[model samples]
Target: MDESVRFDPKSPLFVNDPHGMLSILRERHPVLWGGEARALSGRVFSVWHLFSYADVGAALKDARLMREIRHVLTDEELGRAVPIPEEFQTLVNSQRNMMLFRDPPDHTRLRTLVNKAFTPRMVERLASHIQDIATDLLEPWPAGQRFDLVQEFAFPLPVIVIAELLGVPKADRDRIKSWSRIFTQVLDVEVSLETLVRGNQMTKDFRDYFRDLIAERRRNPQQDLISNLIQVTDDDGGQLSLEELLDMGILLLVAGHETTRNLIANAAWIMCRMPGLADALRRQPDLVPGAIEEVLRLEPPVMLTSRFLAEDLSIQGTAMKRGDEVSLWLAAANRDPAVFAEPDAFRPDRSPNRHLAFGQGIHYCLGAPLARQEGAIALKTLLTRYPRLTLAEADLTWTASTTFRSLTALEVETSAAPQ
Candidate 1:
């Protein structure tokens, strides 16, 4: 590893403009070995970053590159040899059970059940409702006035949609959002111990809340996902255990909205910078889906994901030992010149577009269809309603997390209020 190529993933500069740094890495060290970085729980660990289009795409589906953390580190290596702190143990256990962090049979089983609830028909069914939600959210913002797109629009839109899907009461949306935000901290590559502790508490709170909901659903079924999941049986006529249910619920609630929120906000941010782009989409609403794909390629919500080597392997001539952590830089892969023409340019009409935004292989994002629908609806509706929408400020604030490319807030103004 070249000492000059080392960069902190969590640094403000890197978080704000990762592509700039990533470009250098792709050019010189496509599969650079990035050394120790602190995880959310303040644990330091090493990682190898795959930056090239070829490397990332192959690694995403590479069976040897596994998702389960336990595959990489043994119980003793993870400090589980000694008595673990209760809060830390809760947090660790929660992550271990999450479908995102699991592999093989466990992942396949959980995903199969989830697929039943989050089907294409179900997503298509919500299209009109999603449009209505977007319309309602945009209707209140007066013309020629400014509002935070994240707070007033992007954040609430998906939160409400996912909450409704889960059968969570409207009154409890705020609480759900709070817990989701806390839980998201642990997803970042860098986080404080304090944040981890709070996240553990939120996990417990979420578990208790959903436990009651699950019980209620059993006694009285509803048309929502929670109820459907409760009744969903496996091939053996088995059901998700209580812990599985809670973990899956948390995963759905958090993953369901966070990425969509970022996608919507990122689309708005990009349109604000490019004049007439929004109008072009408004004139041709059919182009919105392609535009969303472009945004996913340019500003992927989740920038990077980790995989551990299941066995010794030589990737692009670099030898990697078994159990070594490999960070697949999806954002960087999307911008690789070898695969994309003018990869940095935001060309909405770019065809043969195969971006790794939703990932590749069996572990690809399950909420991808719903996210696309929500993003297209939200962006098209906003552009149609606020024709002259523009960024309120030249400089914007972004979340200081390497794993997620997100704006803390996006302020915009319209020439005239919607009728």
Candidate 2:
């Protein structure tokens, strides 16, 4: 433990070039014990950063480490830290019930019910539909003109697809997108009171909207996921409760698109910087999947995820006590030299590429197949249609978030219209 290697989560250097800081941490302090700091509302919090690939991988699957919020903070502590008014108990309860924040038996049960909906076969069936959406979104962009790709394409593509999949009415998509953005702030390590309040309101809005949708689905089921989930039964022959259904809807609506949206935007930014990469993909459409994987490895949407020690554990001789939060730098792990040769280089054809972008073990991302399909189709369609795409702006602004590594806007231009 190097007492001098203190990590500031909000440092501009950390946010702008995390891979560089991660390299220093991996080499010097693979398992750094970052002492206490005031994060949420003056509540002191401690963090342990696991930077090395082997350490992070082991910590991810270690039963001694847990993701449930209760392991890190009590209900009272959470309430105090977030400081939501008593009137918003429903909001708090709904957040607490999210499958991402639950431990097993509950995690197992919730995952089991939703597993059938996201199988590779089911996601593959939507490929053509995804391509259609990409075409529809791109058709409106004028040839030889600048357009904000984040607003025009990256964000809407996934939101529209997920909303349609969930059977959400097309008219409600704008409101849903707004709510989804507000709600995602809760995932950040440093959140403001305003953000928390906005999140509560967003949760209430989602619950109200989904309640009616769930009832409609119950009365008149359709050929969509919400309808299927309404009738989905666990092995014990139990269906999702009203609250569970609502939470699931919110989760899918938000998580389904947020990361994928970033994935597409990041891929586009990378392509614009790497000359001829897009043209290469245009020449060989078969490389799209590998290109998407490379983008994920290089610029993962979600940079870090946290887990708390369920019991005292030691990693590479760094002792950690129970209840200490471990921040797994997934972005760091993805570029680990031990696993990846030329860790900093972007090689789409890098075989045996095993990145932790989707995570591992039971808590692996549920929408991975869907995200991959969307990424492949979205990037391939864009490059194939516009063979001469380039960045319209040199100064790009990234989203101000600790969890998500995303651009606020991506302006791009094409030399000509689709052939």
Candidate 3:
């Protein structure tokens, strides 16, 4: 409702071409302002968008604001939003219990349980494994031939690594993928009733599968993440509840796979467009780390985060009353001119990169190390193996997930007469 904020709900700029709108918001109104936000179904939600690095970072730093909004759902709102049947809530709740939805003490406890599993040392170990996985997947891609990187590498790499960590058989990855796709649909702001129904079934199916797996792990424990989690307990000798474990499983599967998939695809697509940067990486592989940082800055996979104003607070000269919705336009913030010089240009070796692609404050991404490792290995391996890479097709299409930004397919011609 600010006087300077302007929005065009009917314009295609609001829908298919939001980056253009975002550029306008960044240039003109970089703080709280009105704009058209889109749903998964391409429906527009009139939202007061913020594009400034300072404003967006401040919003994310607000601990009072809750990120996940399922807890405050009313019966009517839940019905319209999630579309899951009422009877299924308890079952869904059991299978999908993670720290992501909780607050304070509960979140503290849940995160404590899982945090140890993702320590820097553990991530380093996983990084080595990730490198091997990336190499194996990349080997078969007929160097000079065209292939979908998302299908062959990006999507499968993290899924396989996470699956292996969970003691999930490689044979079961397809099932995990199916369940993950359905589970993700339910997270969409606008989901089909049919998708909700199918998602409910997928949740149940995932829970049941994990239930059986846990039972087996209990009997014959293996040296895997699940076994490790089962062995650990609280001071009261209370183990992770069945619900907690199931949700963690779901979280690891989806979070482990989806984000990295997008990161890989998006980074690859961006690099393809910026041939000089890719050439730079090929020439000086040491710059791969810098390139990864730049990728995180420019086209972060998890682009948007939602926060609710927990109490009346004024920020950026705007009154934020309790219960007001605040959208953290992280993708927009990463490109804010105030933060990065030449923010839009793809520049590897760009020093002092403090982009919040992994977020900030207490709720930062737990898998930051793993994601970075996966990206570095994936990009480095591609360049090392082929030495030459080119986009096989122009006008790359993007995936339709609002929260996760990635290429639908990146058709690349590798081994193109090595530069």
Candidate 4:
């Protein structure tokens, strides 16, 4: 570890400029171990932070690095962790059932079922509707007016799209969007007890809400993703459990839109910051796809992910004990010069870009297709409508989280009236 370098994910400076903060440490080490990392359950474990692209990429695919640690940890180790507050138990239970935290059979089961409902054709079909929603969000152009693009545009678009896709009704869109925001707290490395209690209540409310919805779908199936998922069964004729169904709903509702919202907002922020980038894309719309890829490479939605060592492993000659956690800095790896030429410089046209923004292996984001499409459409529509947009605020704020790289608000001001 470099004693001179400090890379605290929660610090304001790190949140504001993660790439700038990670550059030196990444150049110095492929793997940095010998520190304690805190888990959501209030347990502390020995941690290793993987910095280089090759190591992070391989570690993601390594079978020995497990996503869920409870299965491998001894009873004593599990008991040593702080117990969940009684009120927070329900949320924790539902969260545990999510595929994001599962391994092997459970992860395979959930992802397979959801994939049946989330087909490529389904995402492809939403293109026109996504464009329409984006167009309506910017109605009347708001030209010459200052608006928070995040609140007004970027955030709502994905939530509305994902909600509608999940069979949520038109009237419930606003409520679900608010719930989505609160649910993202689960991704934060350090969450306060107050937040946890409030989330407990929110959890109960949404569980009951989904319970009713799932029951209705059972009675009369609809054309939505939830209804489709309910019908999926294994070869032995087993279907998702009621608890599994509810948690899956919550996971999709939260993970579906939140990250994509960041993708769109980050891309917009980048374009505005880079003069003529938006105009160039507007002139040559074919570049939009590559531009989105570049944005994903440059400013990925989820920055870092961690895994527990299922067995003893040696990464770069450093021994990592079984049950220890390693934090893979996907954001840092994306900037690895060994893989990318001039890694920091944005090149929309850069070919053979192999960035792990959406992650890799079995846990690769299921919603990557939809996210890329949504980002492409949303940015294409926005820049097409307003070619001269620029950041309105002198300074921008980001959410304080290690897992999420989302903006608090993206204020934008148009320089002149649209032609």
Clashes of each: 2, 0, 0, 0
User: Candidate 1 overall Cα lDDT vs. reference?
Assistant: 0.87
RMSD of 3: 4.1
Per-residue accuracy of model 2 over 258-349 as CA lDDT, tens digit each: 89999999998988887578778888889889999999998999888888887777889878876678999889899999999999998889
Give all TM-scores, in the order shown: 0.95, 0.94, 0.88, 0.95
Stretches of candidate 2 off by over 4 Å are: 37-45, 69-84, 417-419
Residue 133 alpha-carbon offset, candidate 4, angstroms? 0.7
Q: Write the per-residue lDDT of candidate 1 for residues 1-419, one digit (tens) a residue.
A: 56677667877888888999898888889988787655434445657989998999899888889997567666655553445578667777888898999998888999898888667888888999999889888788866779999999999999899999889998999999999999888878766889989988998899999999999999999989899888898788888888998899999889977889999999999988885787788788889999999999999999999898887788888887766789999999999999999999988899989999999988899999999999999998888777778889888988988889999999898775322
What is the C-alpha lDDT profile of model 4 across 244-297, one tens digit per residue? 999999998898878998999999899889867887898899999999999998
lDDT of each: 0.87, 0.84, 0.74, 0.86
Candidate with best lDDT:
1
Candidate 1: clashing residue pairs, number: 2
lDDT of 4: 0.86
What are the RMSD figures for all models against the true structure? 2.3, 2.5, 4.1, 1.9
Model 4, backbone clash pairs (residues 3+ apart or across chains), number: 0
Structure candidate 2, residue pairs in collision: none
- Best-to-worst order by TM-score is 4, 1, 2, 3
TM-score of 4: 0.95
